[model samples]
Target: MSLFLGTHQNRLDVKGRVSVPASFRSALRKEQTKENHSLIFRPSHKMPCIEVWPLSIFSELTNSLDSLNLFSEEHDDIATTLYAEAWPIDPDREGRILLPDILKEHANLTDSVTFMGLGTIFQIWEPIAAIERCKAARHKVQQKTLAVPPKATKKGVEL
Candidate 1:
């Protein structure tokens, strides 16, 4: 129900807590019961970032991953990395979640952080890392767009 999408940069407090952006918090509330809204955090395999998911979404993702053959090398690697890094957490009364210290260190998170909403899940990034990543991504998109020009349409077409 919480179809979140977009990026928001925020700061973490001294206690290792980050306030869920207003839009993301509202979206998460829509997906879970009022009394039991939960969140999980884990290190991202692709980057120096953390992945955050609602309890419901996390369960759904884990269930899908469960169908994989755990004996296979690929599955074993994924399982070990994901499970070893995962941390289940819930927000405090003030609507902030405590990020694990190890995870924070993994991402090199210091005073500033970036929260990027990606539909079913979200990512936490160190501000500098996030900026560089975004720049690189934008450049790739630009190159692709330039490589393939938009098709011309008839004047009467509704599109």
Candidate 2:
């Protein structure tokens, strides 16, 4: 799995294009399974930002969704929500992708864009909004101590 870490900020050009951060691009390269790697962008239902999913992770999501009964309301709703406005984007040689107008408007992206790394997935946000979200997230987690259990190695040792 790709491990994306750290936050990056970049300018949004007048042409509606923004460069994906170098670190994020490096992570994406590690996750690539084809000559041309693509990213899936979807408006975040839970936040004012655009959620980016590496194709591999998105495939896993689809596979899990397939477990649901076909055409059932639950399945249909989830599929529609995920696919209806999803945009598959290929970053150019310059590591820039054109930000879709709808996505920009959804996130209220203006002069600058902020990239927030979250392991297998990441998010694009408007700078100010991103800062606000970080504050809120930190505040929420301040009252709790959360940690992921270590994974076991091949020799049955925890890591």
Candidate 3:
């Protein structure tokens, strides 16, 4: 399994290029030896974060979505919005990718940004927005946990 790891806050230069955190670059390097891996940035419908995925992962995700009924309104809407917004990007020699102005505006990214790794995909978020979003997520998890305590497990295993 290819696990994406790295969470570093970085600044986007005036030209819209941002360094892909050392850890993330190393992970990408390990995944693609010589061939260049393209990065795709698209607006995330479900959140304020910008969706970013490697071209390989992007293809895999799209293929899975392709199995859905394309004629259905829901599927058509999803496909039109997500696919149309995706922008393919290649990191420069300095391991920085130029974020499209539109994507940056959609994600509310300005001077500073937060890069969060999510296994197969990552998200770019404005600093304040990212902090608030994470806090809300943590609170939601806590509420759910309190509502239903974990059951005892065999061999005393717990999660």
Give the top-scoring candidate (lDDT).
2
Instruction: Report every candidate's CA lDDT.
Output: 0.83, 0.89, 0.83
Residue 50, candidate 2: how far off, in angstroms? Answer: 0.3
When sorted by TM-score, best at the front, the candidate numbers are 2, 3, 1
Better model by TM-score, 1 or 3? 3
Tell me how many clashing residue pairs each candidate has: 0, 0, 0
Q: How far out, in Å, is residue 22 in model 3?
A: 0.6
Give residue 139's lDDT in candidate 3 (0 to 100).
99
The residue-by-residue lDDT of candidate 2 on 44-125, one tens digit each, is 9889999999887888788889789997999999999899989999999999999899999999999899999998899999
lDDT of 1 by residue, 34-103 (tens): 7567787899888899999888777767776777886888788877776787998887767788888999
Q: How many backbone clashes does candidate 2 have?
A: 0
What is the Cα-based lDDT of residue 45 in candidate 3?
86
Q: For each candidate, give its TM-score against the true structure.
A: 0.81, 0.90, 0.83
RMSD of each: 6.3, 2.7, 5.1
Please write out the lDDT profile of model 3 over residues 92-145, one tens digit for every residue: 899988988888888899899998888878899998998898889779989887
Candidate 2 worst ten-residue window by lDDT: 146-155
Error of 3 at 114 (Å): 0.7
